[model samples]
Target chain A: MQMDLVFVGWNHRVASLDLREKLSFTPERAREAMEGLFREKILTEGAVVSTCNRAEIYGLTDLDDSFEALASYFSRFHDVDGSVLRESALSGRGDVTVRHLFRVASGLDSMVLGEAQILGQIRDAHRRATEAGTARTVTHRLFQAALECGKKVRTRTALGTRPTSVPGIALSLVGRIFEEVADCRVLLLGAGETVELTARLLADDGVTRMSFCNRTQEKAAALAAEFGGTVVPWEERIPAFAAADVVLTATGATDPVIPGPEAKRALSKARRRGPLLVLDMAVPRDVDPAVEDVADVYRYDLDAFGELARANAAERQAEVPLAEAIVEESVEKFAAWLASLSMTEVVKQLRFKLEAIRRDELARSEPRLARLDPADREMVERLTEALLNKILHNPTVGLKHGDASQRLELAAAVRTLFKLDGEGRE
Target chain B: MASPSSPGLTNALLGVLALAAYALASVFYTAYLRHPRLKAGRLATGLAVLGAALNFSFLYARSLALKNVPYADLLGSMALFGFFLAGMNLVLEVRHHDRSLGPFLMPVSLLFLLLAFVLPAGGEKRPNLKGAIFAFHVTLNMLSYAAFAVAAALSGLYLVLGKKLKHRSKNVLAGPTARLPSLGYLERAARTSLGVGVVTLAAGLSMGFAWGYHVWRVDHPFWLLDAKIWGAGLTLLFYFVVLVRAHRGAAPVTTARLCIAGFVLVLLSYTAVNLFFSRIHSFT
Candidate 1:
């Protein structure tokens, strides 16, 4: 097998979001890039994966010269210098490469750890490569194994359970205090994408009643209409907070919009009948961090949300060893099957050599048997064939039952003892 | 010639095998939670399967010896229910690749299996028609209970892990636990199980009513005022409420709590009717 594998990519470990944004490839751009790589004759088989956290180029190539060529291709395609691309690139060969791909697919190497979305992302990459006519038997098997490893890890472990995202976190918190979301009311303090996403998450969890109060009333009304929530005027945001059981703030304000005093006043108005979950996803802090100290007000800042996400990411990382063990076991099982192919050739050669020896001996004895009856000669030939069969049976059985290491040792012994090849004597 | 009606040997073997398997599976699952090796998990699953098979054989032999369905007696019913739960757990584990559920599921299975050994094994066989209806009721009820068990476990996990994720904690256990299916999936599962429980309860109750009316006049009945019947009716109502709330899109955590409570009621009804109360249905 020609062992050639290359991973040209950027991820959370090697690059910041700013760098990733510049390097990220849209599906259309990825397709164009793959085609470009093919035109440059840098690789025979290739796939591209682009996600919020990662953008990777996986390919198989034979020429030693092609590695540099492929690295330079990534730089030119992403409008970056060769040195910048090289710093983030990872390359491996043979088993290491196979293991790496399996780990990635299994979510052992994911930014979020155990996220299920990456498996679909990998499948999409493989599908696109096949569509581009770049995926051959080797790449196909490699990708298929990776997908299987991902599935096995998911089913056999608890690594993929629970939401790790900010939106997911906010909804889960709201779920805890309320028996059901239908009875709970929500107040959203922004009209940005983060708030919209959080609203969608909460809606999915059965939080039907909500109020959106943004700096702009039009933006609030528009967002509220999509989710069937009412829009509150910005001036009455604190009073709106009193009506809500949960508050999520993700505004673009330079300072805290919902101060600690305002939060405390709202909490007192509700008479602490229910807790208020506040999610502050703004960079500059939409809600004062001190609001968390208020009784019955659970406020989480961006850092806290990020820590939860990271902690969840770490928990998933812990499962990586177990997931890798499964992948390793699978790879060994597959390699044994591959090794068995060599046994077929060995068996064929042994039979051919044995048959040649039998024929030579028969030829020498032909003149002596010519004087005997035809029936007697036929009996001698049958006896000779049976003796040869008996001798070969034990080795053949051993080869079938044994793994690659055992088979290799046995094959070596057979070749050396029989001197089947003249080079064995040397 | 000796009589062939004794299941002494078969019952003993089954009891031993079931207990051993239950213990082994529980340990393996616990180890799997800690180490999470596929080898350990696969071993646990295999033992569970073997245990189920042995339990099935025991039930068959017992049924043959008694010349009636094995579920007729309290012990036999408990054993049958245990087998059903164990079988369901294995299937779910295999299907979802979720072994975290084992610690929760195996104890329930083992408890039933142990109860099976303690209760009397032989009972008076009812008529064939009544026996068929009895079997139908018990089987469906057991299946519904199994589904509810799963829903309860998933919901419990969701409540804890969901809370941790929300607070943005760094707890490893909270992070690695599989994301509970969207609240929608859990609610749907809970509703479906509740619906099945209700339907099964209705069928069972209706059959009891028909049988009671036949034995007595319209105004007076032999088993009309049985505690088992009332308990079952109440349990059905509980699930009815759960189903309604779920249909209206209840939060998964809330629905899960209801499901857990409903299942607990089911267990109480099943136990009280079979073990403590005497009624026309208590042929055991």
Candidate 2:
């Protein structure tokens, strides 16, 4: 019989976030659920992979209606509505299942395309299933292959190397301007949400010094308090520019807050370790446009950031075909292995059935054979064996090369026609 | 001035092969800039090292042919400049762990090799290159010129990267600028080259002046007033000003532009002044 495995899931594409959250499994919950599946005899082996954006199950099952069994298991486990689960569910069996698991591991199926966290999530899910005695050899093989494919895609593609989000862009921009972010001071012109987010990202990148200035003193003080830094009064922000290596501005100003000549003079007096970087993320602008003409200053307004984000998105999207090709090749290999397993069974059953028939006929004619010479009897036996070997050769060769589905169908046909399964389990 | 004789066939062949090797190395380095995962950077460095060895062997063979030193002529001097540049580039690549600079630096040495092929080799014995003092002056001058070339290349990169950043972040990140280090790093590296240039150029000019006053006083009493000396002196003065003032106070872009201008003056002093207006001395 073919080793039939199945994949079932709801992800960001098919399910609402609320449904996904309800379906999400912690490690303990996933392990308990898989153990319950074994107890119920619903699956031979299974793994539940649960994360913020998706929860998927991979299983090795003998049941013909294993997809429906798994769908009902979600209702029993998470108490989610069965109708909603069935509607949002994505189901694939055999090689389709293998491809689905590989895609998810490779981050092609992630909410954020090509994000790396899913690979680790897949590993953790596999680990929990193994610990719960739910993932045996077949499930283990499938997950190991998925992990390998994920690693290959990450290394071979440029999907995850470039930054796309605003915080990510801010970090990349800082990297481009400063040799070392730790030694530099950042001056925030306003403590609005964008400015606040920029502060947190810069802090994470190892900027030890940050001075916050805002129209609201409490907001500036609050940002400064959270990340160890000083707070400058709003009026003295221009003079504070002299101390900053990177100046981030997102204030609600009608006119330019940092004038071209004044900003130039103030930044000229700035302690020189690197070129001054200014990011004007404000609406009516904070830094003057003329500041871009300054020799030591590197400036990026809001439009530049958006353009860079779009380019990163396009570049990442372009890597999909290449990643999918890897997934396809991996799935084909899995299919071939499953085919080989089925071929082995078919060959064994055919040989056994033929040998049993030959033995029974020989036993019934034993007395008549005894009348012949010993050499004649041996020749008769050899002829029978040679005929059986010749019969099995052609069918075995045909079975060896086809896909898993073809091999499974051919194996089932051989079993039923020959009555190789004595109890008629076929 | 000493006018070295024509190089032997063997020495000329080695020099041409060395130049070809360096040119190929530059192609690999440029490829590395575009596709870093190809790992062509290491191969580029290997080829560059091979070229430097061959170039050295050529210099040695030429010296053996002349039965004295090799750098007494214009061709020999240019070849020495190329060799020093190749060596300096290797050092920079190692220090910065950056392969993008190879495309910028290797072509300069290639140009020097090309110029060496066209210029006449001076006689082995007697003009402005008579003694050990003259060799010392010429070697120092060549080293200084190589340093200026490095500064100019890095400064050119700085200007290009700055222009790229102003126009679009995507353009900067996707293009060749992606392979470059930060603008601050480039500026600092160029500044370091400028410092080395200033020191070496000062020493070379001092040696030239003392040697000139000592040797040319009796024969050409007005040798100090030669167009070559004035051009070299002005080039030195311009670099010295830029190195001291333009770097510390002026904007980095202005500093980079000044550095490029300083290199222009150096080329003029080396090429235009020596070719047209030098009265008592001839390196070629």
lDDT of 2 by residue, A17-87 (tens): 99998998888888887788777766667788888888888887666787888899888789989889999
TM-score for each prediction?
0.56, 0.83
What range of 10 consecutive residues in model 2 chain A has the weakest lDDT sum?
A400-409
Q: What would the TM-score be for candidate 2 when compared with the true structure?
A: 0.83
Candidate 2 clashing pairs, residues 3+ apart or interchain: B1-B127, B1-B128, B2-B127, B3-B122, B3-B123, B4-B122, B4-B123
lDDT of 2 at A303: 85
Pairs in steric clash, model 1: A155-B97, A160-B178, A161-B177, A161-B178, A161-B179, A162-B178, A162-B179
- Winner by lDDT: 2
The residue-level lDDT of candidate 2 at B269 comes to 86
Candidate 2 docking: what grade? acceptable
* Docking quality (DockQ) for each candidate: 0.10, 0.42
TM-score of chain B of each: 0.83, 0.94
